[model samples]
Target: MAIENRNICSLYDDEKENLLLLHSAELLENISQSKEKYRKIIQAGMAQWVKGLQEGRIKLDTVADLKLLIELDIQLQKDEEI
Candidate 1:
């Protein structure tokens, strides 16, 4: 009976490990997708900001939020290095 119980525990452990691996893969995929999504969105925002600034639609000193977005873009680049 003890041997049978040990085998069952071992089976459960293998299953757990396999599930963990699968979930890890899924998590990495989601992270990659999110990074790409943010990269595109940020790039588009920066382009629009440049266009607005050039067209006299935006005052650089009044848009602190855009500065925050620029910081986020910098952070994203740092993350890619890791």
Candidate 2:
């Protein structure tokens, strides 16, 4: 639903709710946990991708899309210590 241009209160209320969530510890922790889970999933995918490459299921010349997965894995690994 669109907020009415004349309804300043609606905008103010939405901003206040966003600020509350920003300061919520539960929300922050949940976000951190979700990121770690997603990182693990991507790592698993990378492992399988390597297996495919070794078994000749994946082609060396058809690695353009794999480059994107590698980039994302690298970016996430930069944040993950273990």
Best by the lDDT measure: 1
Off by over 4 Å in 2: 1-23, 77-82
Query: How many pairs of residues in model 2 come into backbone collision?
Result: 0
Candidate 1 local lDDT, 1-82, one digit each (tens): 3455445356677787987899999998898789889988998998888888999999878577678779988998888777
Query: Listing every candidate in turn, what is its Cα RMSD in Å to the true structure after a full C-alpha superposition?
Result: 4.5, 8.1
lDDT (Cα atoms) of all candidates against the true structure: 0.83, 0.77
Clashing residue pairs in candidate 2 are none
How high is each candidate's TM-score? Answer: 0.74, 0.59
Tens digit per residue, CA lDDT, model 2, 15-65: 878768777968767877987888788788878888999999998997876
Give the poorly placed runs of model 1, Cα more than 4 Å off: 1-10
Tell me how many clashing residue pairs each candidate has: 0, 0
